[model samples]
Target: MSRVLVTGAASGLGEALSAAFEARGDEVLRTDVSYERGFETGASAPSSTSGGYRLDITSDDDWAAALAHVESTWGGLDVLVNNAGVAGGGRLDVATMDEWQWITEINLFGAVRGTRTFVPMFKRQRSGRIVNTASLAGLVHPAGMASYNASKAAVVALTETTGHELAAYGVTAHVVCPSYFRTSLMSSLRGADTALAEVMSKLVDESPVSADDIAAAVLEGLDRGDELIVPDQAARDAHALKQTDRATYDVVMRAQAVKLEEGAR
Candidate 1:
C-alpha cells in the first residue's frame, strides 16, 4: 500500500508499471504530458487514490503543480519513478544541438527536477524511494546513440548520488538499467540515420524480453531495496563487460560500431 507516482504512465513500461502497482493494492498516481484518447492506460490524469493527471516532466511549473496535488491529496509521497523519457539518436559529430538539449531536459533534467521537488517532502516524512529508468545503452555506450546514452548515464550517476544523500533520511534510490524489450518507447524515438535505426530495430526485435519483465524487475528490486536493477540478461552482460575490462570493452565496442556501419552499407 505504498503511495507511488510514476511519470510517462501512458504506455510501455510506465503504463504496465502503473497497472502492476495498482494491482498490488498500492496507491498509484500516473502522469504524462497528455491523457489523450489512445493514452487510456496512462490517461487517468485526475488525482485520486488510483487515478492520474497531466504532468509535463520537463516543466518546473508542472512538477510543482503535481507536488501540490500530492500534498493536498496524499499528504505525503512514498515512491517516485522518473520513467518518462524520449529517445534521441545520432553520432556526436552530426548530432543536433537542439536534440541534445531536448533529450537531456526530459531524460536527465526531468529526473533531477522531480527528485529536487520531492526531496523536502521526503525529508519531512523521512522515508521514500526514487526509482530511475536508465538503459543498457548508458552502460554499453553503443555508437550512434550518444545523446540517449549520455543522458541515461547521467541519470545513473544522479540516482546514486541522491541515494547516498537521502540514505540518512531513510529515503532510498533505485536505478533500473534495462536492455531492449517490447515497449512503446520506440514510438517516441526520433533518429537522423535510417541505417542506425534499422540496425537498432533489428537488435531490439531480437531481444528476448518484454516491458512487463522490466516492470516486474523494478518492483522486485524496490522490494529488495536493491540500488541497481539490471532487468534482463543482456543488460547484466553489458554492465559486466564494462566492469571486467574497460579498455578491451571500448575497443570491441568501437570495432562493433564499425562492423554495424559496414553491414548497413
Candidate 2:
C-alpha cells in the first residue's frame, strides 16, 4: 500500500480522501490548520491508524516541519495530495488586494509550496504521485469568483507542467477539477462586501456535485493514471464546452455574471 499525505484533512474532501486511502490499507498522514479538531472529528474518527498533523499551508516553515515529520516517521511518501484551499467571491474590480492575496496564498501558493518541497523527496524515491485539487471554475470563467477561479486555474497549469517534468522520475502528477462538491468551501466564500453574501449563497446552492462523488473520482483517476480528472458530469460538460465553442462559452459566462449581480441585489 502507498504512504499518503493529505493537506486540508480537517474536513470535507480532504478528510474523505484520507479515509478512502486508509481504508484501502495505505498509511495516511492527514494535516490541517486545526490539528486537534480535525484529528478527533475527521481523520482519526474515520481511520485511527492514520496520523494527523497541524499544518498551515501558507507557511513554508510549517510545510518543512510536516515534511520532516513524515520523512522521520514514514521513511518516504508515495503520494502527496494538496487538497487545502479557500473560496472567495466578488468581481475582480470589487475585491480588495488583501482578499485576493489571502485566497491565492492558500489556494495557489500553498499547492506550489507543497509541490516544490516534496518533489525532491519523491525524486529520491524515484516514484510518487502528486494530486492537486483544482475546480471546474478553473476551466470555465464564472462571474463573481475571479480570485477563486484564477487560483484553481493556476493549479491546473502547475500540475500539467510538473507532470511533464516528473515523468522521467516515474512521479505522476494529477489535477482534479471538480464541480461544486458539498464542502465548507462554499460556506467560507468571502464577499467583496457584506451585501454580496446572498449572491454567493445562491451560486453555491446551485452546485450539483457532492464531496463524496469527487473523492471517488479522484481515486479512480489515480488508479487510471489520468493527468486531468474532471470529477463530475457538470465539470466534464464545462470542460467540453471550452474545447468545442469558445465564443458561446464566453456568452454563457457573461450571462452568469448578470445573474450573479442580480441575485446580489
Candidate 3:
C-alpha cells in the first residue's frame, strides 16, 4: 500500500479523501491546522498510528515537521495531497488587499510550500505524485470571486509547471478542479462581501454531489494519470463551453455579472 499525506483532514473533502485512501488499503496521514477540532472519524482524538499532524500550511516550520514525520514514520512518501484551503472572494473593487493576501497565502502558497518541501525527497525517490485541490473557479473565473479564482488558478498553473519540471524524475502532479459540492469548506469562508458569501454558500449546500463523490473521481483521475481533473459534471460542462464556445461562455458569465450588479443595486 502506498503512503499518502493529506492536509485539512479533519473534515469535508479532506476527511473524505483520507477515508477513501484508507478504504483502498493505503496508509494515510490526516492533518489540519487544529487537531483540537477533532476528526469526524469516531475517535475523539488522533493516536500515534493516526499520523495526524497540526500542520499550518503557511508555516515553514510546520512544513519541515511534516516532512520529518513522514520520513521517520513511513520511511518515504508516495503521494502528497495538498487539499487544505479556505473559501473567500468578492468583486475586484470590493475585495480588500488584505483579504486577497490572506486567501492567496493559504489557498495558493500553502500548496506551494507543501510541494516545495517534498519535491527534493520525491526527486531522490524518482517516484511520487502531488495532488492539489483547486476549484472550477480556477478554470472558469466567475464574477465576484476574484480572490478565490486567482488563487486557485495559480494552483493549477503550479501543478502544471511541476508536472513538466519533474517528468524526468517520474514525479507527477494533478490538480483537482471540482464545481461547488457539499463540503465544510464553507465554514472557513471569509470576505468583505457578505452577500456574495451567502450566495456561494447556498450554491455549495444545494449541490447534489458530496465530498465522497469528488474524492472517488479524484482517485480515478489519478489512476488515469490525468493532470487536470474536473470531477464534477457542472465543472466539466462549463469548462467545455469555455473551450469550445466563447460566445456562449461570455453570455453566461456576463449574465452572472449582470445579476451581481443588479443584486448590489
Candidate 4:
C-alpha cells in the first residue's frame, strides 16, 4: 500500500481523501494545525489538541518533524497531499493586510513549505505524487475572495512548476481545482460572512456533486496523469470560460461583485 500524508486530513476534502486512501489499504498519516478544536474535523468549537498528528503548515520545524515521523514510522512517503486551506471574504477596501498574510501563510506558503520539504525526499525515492488542493477561485477569481484567489493561484503555479520539473524524474504532480462542494469550507471562513457563506452553501446545495464526487475526480486525475485536475463541472467550465471567452466571464464576475456590494449595503 502507498504511504500518504494528507494535510488538513481531519475534515472536508482532506478527510474524504484520507478515507479513500485508507480504504485502499494505504498507510495514511493525517496532520492539521490543531486537532483540539476539530477544525481539523469540521467541528466549530475548540477542543484539546491531539498529540502526534498536530502540524502547523506554516512552520518549517513542524515540517521537519513530520517528515522525521514519517521516516521513522512509515520508512518513506509515497504521496503528499497539501490540502490544508482556509476561507475568508474581503476586498481591498475592507480586508486588512494581516488577513491577507494569514490566508497566504496557510493557503499558499503552506503548500510551498510542503513541496519544498518533500521534493528532495521524492527525488531520492525517484517515484512520488504531489497532489495539491487548489481551488476554482484560483482560475475564476471573484470579489470577496481576493486573498483566497491569490493564494490558490500560487498553489496552482507551484504545483505546475513542480510537475514540469518532476515529470522527467518519474515523480507525478497534479493540482486539484475544485468548485464548491458540500463541505464546511464555506462555514470555515473568517468572521460570520454568512451572506457569502449562504451564497456558496446555496450553490453547493443545488449542485449535483459532493466531497465524495470531487475525491473520485482527484483519483481519476491521478490515474490519467492529468496536470490540472478540475474536479467539478463548475470548475472545468469556469477554467475554460476564463481562457476562451474571458469577456463574458468578466461580465459575470462583475455581476457577482455588484450582488456582494448590495448585500453588504
Indicate which candidate wins on lDDT: 3
- For all candidates, what are the clash counts? 3, 0, 0, 3
Model 1 bad stretches (over 4 Å): 36-51, 263-265
Over the full model, what C-alpha lDDT does candidate 4 score relative to the true structure? 0.81
Question: When superposed on Cα atoms, how far off is each prediction in RMSD?
Answer: 3.2, 3.2, 3.3, 5.1
**Lowest-sum lDDT 10-residue window in model 1:** 37-46
Q: List the pairs of residues colliding in candidate 4.
A: 36-47, 36-48, 37-47
* Model 2 lDDT tens row, 215-253: 888898889989999988888988898899988899998
User: How far off is residue 249 in model 2, in Å?
Assistant: 1.3
Candidates 2 and 4, the one with greater lDDT: 2
Native-vs-model 3 lDDT?
A: 0.90
lDDT (10s digit) by residue, model 4, range 142-238: 9877877899999989998999899877898889999888886765677334566557668766777788889888988887989899988888888
Q: Could you tell me every candidate's TM-score relative to the true structure? A: 0.92, 0.91, 0.95, 0.88
Tens digits of per-residue lDDT, candidate 1, 1-265, equal 8888999998889988888898898888888887532223333333444455778888888888878877876799999999999877777665788888888989999999999999999999999999998888767788888899999999999999999999999999989899888777777777666677776777767767878888988888888889998988888887898999898889989997897678666
Computed on alpha carbons, the lDDT of every model, listed in order, comes to 0.84, 0.82, 0.90, 0.81
Error of 3 at 240 (Å): 0.4
Better of 1 and 2 by lDDT: 1
Rank candidates by TM-score, best first: 3, 1, 2, 4
Best by TM-score: 3
The digit string of per-residue lDDT tens for model 3 on 53-159 reads 68899999888877877776567899999999999999888889999999999999999999999999999999999999999999999899999999999999999
